[model samples]
Target: MPMPAQEIEELIRAGIPDAQVEITDLAGDGDHYSARVVAESFRGLPRVRQHQLVYEALGGRMGGALHALQLTTACPTEE
Candidate 1:
């Protein structure tokens, strides 16, 4: 089954309790998503690493139940 946006947000929040997560369903299908994740913990990480953190939060669900995710990550200060 395709992953729901709420589930995605939940998983991310579970991983980063202080994170602000926003998930949008792209293509009107649950299989594709766009997520904006902002966290204080991301302050020192590079962009690639930031994305990795969000992916890790999904517990390996990407490409399986989650399919594709276009993710954008930033520190809280980045706005």
Candidate 2:
């Protein structure tokens, strides 16, 4: 079975707590998704590390229940 977009967002939020997450089904299919995650905690992190955090939040589901994820991560803009 494929993962739901809401579940993905929820999982990210659960892991990042203060993150703002946006999930989109790029192919209109549950297996392919794109996620944008923004969090204050990512401020000083490298892009690779930021992506790792999001991957970790998925809890090893990357190749199983979830097929593909195009992820974008960033710190919240200073405003």
Question: In model 1, where is the ten-residue run with the lowest total lDDT?
Answer: 70-79
Candidate 1 lDDT by residue in tens digits, 1-74: 98889999999999989999999999888999999999999998899999988889999998899999999998
Writing each residue's lDDT as its tens digit, candidate 2 over 1-79 gives: 9899999999999999999999999999799999999999999999999999999998999989999999999998887
- Residue ranges of candidate 2 with Cα displaced over 4 Å: none
List, in order, the clash count of every candidate structure: 0, 0
lDDT score for candidate 2 against the true structure: 0.94
Task: Kindly state the number of residue pairs that clash in model 2.
Answer: 0
Task: Indicate the residue-level lDDT of 71 in model 2.
Answer: 94
